[model samples]
Target: MSADKPKPAGVKIVDAAKKELMNVSAIERDGNFLVVKGKIFGTMPMTAKLSPEEARKALRMLSPGLVWFLLTFPFRRSPEPPAR
Candidate 1:
């Protein structure tokens, strides 16, 4: 590690699957890995397991605001159901 880049501190493993799925810069040491991630909007941290090609394809499928709108759309509905 260089002075410009600091090392990550190791925390006890929670769940291996959870750890793997987390969005973090990870380091492997002594047969274990430590991951550091940030929470987005108090929700679960978002992680990308997709390859670059897959990610690019996904990004091209939606407009910038479309994803956000779809995610938030369910919450913007009326309290009562619409009559047919």
Candidate 2:
């Protein structure tokens, strides 16, 4: 990695203590791969390409958590509005 070249968003570390959050802007299919475009910490642009197998694995891992969230979503209270 050269100093002049910017690091890839996935590997870049902004703050060690703070948790990094990726805000996915778009997901596009490029041929046989899936291209994920997002911003890390809501600022740095990131792009990731995943093969079919990788996408399936990611789906399998995320499905359970997504299902659980959907099942309990109605019961969960919304966050309190910020004071003016």
Q: How many collisions per candidate?
A: 0, 0
**Model 1 regions lying over 4 Å from their true place:** 1-50, 78-80
lDDT of 1: 0.51
Error of 2 at 59 (Å): 4.8
Question: Which number leads on lDDT?
Answer: 2
Worst 10 residues of 2 by lDDT: 7-16
The alpha-carbon deviation from the true structure for residue 64 of candidate 2, after best TM-score superposition, in angstroms, is: 7.4
**TM-score (C-alpha) between model 1 and the true structure:** 0.26
Look at candidate 1 and tell me the lDDT of residue 58: 76
Model 1 per-residue lDDT tens digits across residues 6-78: 6664333335334432334443332232223444333465433445566578789998699999889778963
Per-residue lDDT, model 1, residue 37, is 49
Model 2 vs. true fold: TM:
0.46
On TM-score, the candidate that comes out on top is: 2
Evaluate all candidate structures by whole-model CA lDDT and list the values in order. 0.51, 0.75
